[model samples]
Target chain A: MDPVGLSGYLTVGAVLFVCGVICMATKRNAVGVLMGVELVLNGANINFVAFSRHTALGLDGQIASLFVIVLAAAEAAVALAIVLNFYNNHLTIDVDRAVELKG
Target chain B: MSVPELLNHVLHTDLPRSVQIFAPELVLCVTIIALLLVRMLKWHHKFPTSWVALFGTLAAFVGVFAQFMYMKTGGELPQMRELFEFWGLTQAGVGTAGEYFTGLLVHDPFAVFFRLGLVLFLVLVQALTILTGIPDQEDGQDFYTLMIGATIGMMLACGANNLLMLFMAVEMMSVPSYAMVGFLKGRRLSSEAALKYVVYGAGIAGVMVYGVSLLAGVLGTLSIPELGSRFELLMGDQPFSLTNPTAVATALGIMLVVVGLAFKLSLVPFHFWCPDAFEGASAEVGGFLSVASKAAAFALLVRFALAFQGSGEAIQTLCLIFGISLGVVSCLSMTLGNLAAYTQTNLKRLLAYSTIAHAGYMVMAISALMVLLSGSADPVDSAACVEGLMYYIAVYLFMNLTAFAVVAFVRNETYREDIEAYNGLSAGGPMTKLLCFCLLIAFVSLVGLPPMGGFFGKFAIFASALKAGSVHWFLWVVLAIGGLNTVFSLFYYLKVLRAVFILPSADESRTVEIPGFNGAYVALITLPILALGMSWVMGDLTATAHDVAAYLFH
Candidate 1:
């Protein structure tokens, strides 16, 4: 079997990104939406690492992926905390319920 | 080339210079730590955290001001050198323009200008918080910590030179802001706003980072300045076409990245979160998001868009496309923001739409800059484009802040934020009249009236756009749309003013009496808008903005 190439890795990354976007669009649960965000970030992480190995990006891509991981974690923490606050107020984590400020 | 040599050079030479250039951000970091420590040590009983935050912000502002003066004076000022030395900072890279921290960030007049504005804004916001008393003594430390943290993120955004730095800076600015939107704990609206903001922000950020990865992989570089040269090399003599796979990938990546920035700017189709966020958040947070965050995002957008500029025909074509698209987006944002604002009864929501409209005007200036730069126009036209943007941002800081500050003060007095709350405001008392007068100035300036800063800001932007239109006729349409939007915007602003000066009080017994101190605060902020409209002050500011903008082209 041939080794997985850069194109293969990018294909997987693109699929993941598409799935994440679809999930974010369809999910009504706030946490599920946040999970979609995670999937999207991880997809980018895959591309970064694959680029680091296959392209002239070298260490920069790897470093960027590392930073993205840390940032994603930070973002998730904040998102979950906000979701918790929403839950506390509305007694549910459904984003549809957060229509108090709509125009 | 060995490890020891690289380490020695970085440790001794690069580190010190970067630190000196980064003094303001470091001071803010220290202030954040101090706020946390104050809370941890339970010292809030004796000393107020707001004063601590204010002093720290003032110190940061002074540091940035010193840096601005040093750059403006060409670093030959003796007193400035003495001040740097007193702070235990070296003079290395103090007055010079270059990349610092291994080229992850830049120290230039443009960045310093934004830094000065952001830090000064931090000072003003801290003072406003103290006067308005939103985050009481119990929550002062948390509020200041989050506020300062977000500010540091914005400062980083102004200086980011690498794609990674740009992404990090944006997140740093955004995450804390989400928390700030929900700072009014137990308030359903605040929590909902925060939740919506975070979900939308996270999704957009993820998409943006994916675009960054694609661009990095395709171009084989992540440094912003290097992207253009790499693109030139990649395309060589080939014409730009959709059929080319590399061109297709590059366009997709650029569009995705722009989507993220448009979210921050609250341009059309991405502005759904803006009015909701502002209406749900407190007026103070709303003001911060509208002004400071917008300023930082604009700075980042300028840097990011200009990164693709080069002499190559393909690159120029690409930039021209970006310019036209941005012009279209600017038109849509302005028209929609104004048309939507006409029906808003909540004062904060109206300002939100106004914020979106003002953002559109600023983005139009950027569109002109991109178009002019891509064409063979003289360098001065492009510089004027940037100068227009800078002047507009400087004036906008005051206009938006005063408007939101009035909302906050009224909310404090009446516990209401509806336009009806401001009815007969001018007839109440001296203090209420002062508030009414300040709001009138803010709204009139926002409508681009003369003898106010917003007038000059709008004129500079429109003049520059006209210059760009001479290069490309599409910008002419944008300029006309901007004009119509400005005229259309006047009615909504007057609608609010009519409530203040024309309508009788709904409840005459409920007179809105602001304290003398808060009245002075409003007047203090209003003074700059009035003063900037003066010929001499506007002239000096124009020259300063011109200088800063000149450096970008070089």
Candidate 2:
């Protein structure tokens, strides 16, 4: 009856979580990191729906998880849009190069 | 039933309350499709296309307003049910839906209030776009679609009953905005802004997702109301107690979830991309990004915070710590934003920092929200903070959009967009100068000054902090600093106002004619700035804020 079988979902979530961490730590594409965020959300989303099916707490788990996924997506889209415009202006996709306002 | 048959069954028959609760988003979906069809037509001039976009928003606004007026409340049922509603679902607790959309969503006052605020802002943004004519610059079909689509995503973010829905709504809103950020594709700074926005967005979103996984895997539920119910049931003696390892893990999940949501709100540590993106993007996009998006994110925050509300020491301690620290960090953000604004000669970049300062104000309201919910606080005091934040955001939509309208107006003529360019506006254009003075008052309001709603907004939050008696010093210090910052902010506002009214036009011979529609639009926005002084109109805000407090506190 365990949809994620605990460890399987855990492993997927772990991989996604680590991948997102790695993406945030390493990627310079900006939009690529956004994709990584989407992946991380998908991983977590898998866990939520999985748990909803598996546990006594029932549908609430899946519902809250659904809200998280939607908000993350909205944030990502706007951020990516902003990044696209930023790159249009700055002529670079690299994050380290965007420190002009730091002073 | 077969797959298509079952799908039709859910579509054709009675809709659950959760779907009805999300009615505004449903209306927007219809508008988006209509906009998509408009993209095919070759317009002789772009004004009609823009009108289609504008009226589409107006229509959507009407729909949301009507839905809000007719919305059924949970805990108490409405006398009658509407034949049509969000996602085609019936009203919750009033009509049935197999535990409210199979427990992936709920129809509560909390989500409804947030959704109403979001729709109001969306209408404002659409109206601003119409008034300003930002579409005059390019082929703008995709622009309108993306704007509407992103807005729908924002509404969904407010009502997401399931984590999966949350992620989907977030992406639905994010993707279009990414494209929109880069919509002015030829501009160097616009592209740079888009890139920075995307990177920052991805990083925070990823962090939040990891947080989500932790919550779901440990606590085994993603449904918010159910999570609230189960977390309440947990321990049977003391609620939300982590002393039981399972509860502890759930508590940890809640922390991580806060991290994800905070990234959206642009709280410290996650606020890096805001200034850059704001600076790099155009004024209209920047304004939209700053206000509408943040309001939606706050909707998520309010819901999630209440979801974890319990009688446990650990959870309450977490709330208290976060609330207090967020207050200090908010002060820092405000200082940083104002100081940054002072040095900027470019009007767009200056407005960018102003957006940051406004964000700090919103966060300040949120921190107060946390304090009010902790049961240890007085109920009456909590009500002030709740109402204050709600009214602040509502007034903020009108005030901020007015400021952006001025920017758009000036930008349209001569295509120059720097503070220096505004130097001669007064002599050349009287109406523009008048509008600039009105916007100056708006700036004053944003600074939380009197005769403007911003003053009461600030007063309410400060009063709540005083009433709570827990963060007395923090509140007083913030007030002192906020008062000082208001003075500092006045200098820059006056600087812009002087350019518009006191200074001579760079060319003394030229006079600018005010277009009828644009003039009326600015005039329309002007009324509310002064309305802030009327206590009768302002009195309702405190009551509404109390309702917001009651939802979370109850």
- Docking quality (DockQ) for each candidate: 0.89, 0.42
Task: Provide the TM-score of chain B versus the true chain B for each model in turn.
Answer: 0.98, 0.86
**lDDT score for residue B468 of model 2:** 44
> Model 1: clashing residue pairs?
none
Instruction: Please provide, for model 2 over B1-554, each residue's C-alpha lDDT reduced to its tens digit, 9 standing for 90 to 100.
Output: 69998777566543534445445566677767766666655552554666676676666665555444444333233432342343243343323323345555554445556667666666666676766666553455567778888888887776677655555566666667666666667776666666766666666655666666566555556566556556555545564444677666676676666766666666656666776666666677777877778777777766676565556665565566556666786787777778778887777777777777777766776676666555466655665676677777778777777887777777777577778777767554567657666677777787777778877776776666555445435655765665667677777777777776677777666665556677577778766756754667666655555665565555
Prediction 2 TM-score vs. true:
0.83
- Lowest lDDT 10-mer window, candidate 1 chain A? A1-10
Candidate number of the best lDDT: 1
lDDT per residue (tens digit) for residues B346-407 in model 1: 99999999888999999999899889878967888888888999999999999899999999
Runs in model 2 deviating more than 4 A are A1-16, A29-92, A97-103, B1-21, B41-47, B71-100, B108-110, B136-138, B232-252, B471-484, B503-514, B548-554
Q: For candidate 1, give the docking quality class from DockQ.
A: high
Candidate lDDT (C-alpha), each: 0.91, 0.65
